[model samples]
Target: MTAVADLFNLKGQTALITGGSSGLGLQIAEALGTQGARVVISARKADVLESAQAHLAGLDVDASWIAADNAREDHVERLANDAMERLGKIDILVNNAGATWGAATADHPLSAWDKVMNLNVRAIFLLTQQIGRLSMIPNRYGRVINVASIAGLKGNGPTSQPTIAYNTSKGAVVNFTRALAGEWGKYGITVNALAPGFFPSKMTRGMIEKVGIEKLAERAPLQRIGDDDDLKGAALLFASDAGKHITGQILAVDGGVTAV
Candidate 1:
């Protein structure tokens, strides 16, 4: 006899979002926080994390943040432990931290390739493992939201900005979501991913400038790029009880671009 709205209510839940200082991470934090979940955000820079915490407060969202680079193992371990200490238990996790590099395959530096793969793939596995083992697995209840990209779903030709490493890393993330979802379901945890299209963020600034926002928008049937709020609904669904029966799914929030 649960009320319809009660399914989406997160009054007692808590979430930890990596790379949450800005962009889509910030947006997802807002979505979950506004719905009544305590939120903790993490990123590499202290100043930016402070700013994001302040912004969340302005929205009346109970939010906190930690400054940590997910690319490093030490930082990942500390982030997981500290977040659990701060929130008691994490009912939801958003693996939103990521990195990208743009270079032709031939000229792509090995160091840069390592950087992208480390953050986009390795960091995700580590954090998810830490959080899952410590919190989610013990509770037998959890939600994991991975932030993937449309680039992972398809390949880009030479005409577009060359980002082979970034693309490859994201593709790994897509499959990682599927593989983990299959394994974790037995533990009463649901793992899902969000594959977003072009949005106005620091990560996409270069691509947007090179191709023009209008041009990118035209690629989608919606004829518009994603807005700040585009991911809120889908994010909420996967985080709440509304998505209890769903897992191993990658929902694309790309304004119909992938549909075409």
Candidate 2:
């Protein structure tokens, strides 16, 4: 009696996505919102959050936003509280807010390293804990989708760009997803991660400029870079009942870059 297309229906669910103002975060937000989830996006900038909210409106997606820095403990707490207040309940949580600093390992600044870790890893842990405790656990159901990167799966060659801290933090996310899934399974929460390769975003603009888009595309077996729609299906799967039985998994949304 369940239609195949109905498996992905999220008409009554709600999602909270951090760093959702732009880049991969915004893309994921669009996917969930269009699929029928009431979405609440958060980031550090009010201006950008407003823009993203407007963009979602244009697409006829039900959406709202909060501007808060996830790197701060107080801000994280407030964000989780405010999102639940606005959305009524959070059925899905997307930890997509992240930062990166490009520098050789030995020359990387301790301050920058801390900054990246605080945002990319620690923020995720804190938000997940709070949201899980307050909403998902009590409800006995939830979906957590972490936006890791392909950089976490492998080390950059000696000649590659130096982003030691960024890579390290993302690697932590991969394990974090697995560990959290193991612990949260009892609560009916499914935790998984998406490790994306070369996507055109503010974060990767510099790298794409340095390496050239054609060269980067060549690195993938598909011989092309990822586009807007590439991550939608995978995101929908993890956030929907379709992935109820799937957890603790890491899916690489690269054009087969990690395979080779």
Question: Model 1: per-residue lDDT, tens digit, 3-94?
Answer: 87999999999999998999999999999999999999999999999999999999999999999999999999999999999999999999
**What TM-score does each of the candidates earn?**
0.98, 0.98
- Provide the overall lDDT of each model, using Cα atoms, as 2-decimal numbers: 0.95, 0.95
Candidate 2 lDDT tens digits, 101-213: 99988899999999999999999999999999889999999999999999999999777888999999999999999999999999999999999998999888998889999
- Going through the candidates in the order shown, the clash numbers are 0, 0
Residue 11 deviation, candidate 1, in Å?
0.7
Candidate 1 global lDDT: 0.95
Backbone clash total for model 2 is 0
Clashing pairs in 2: none
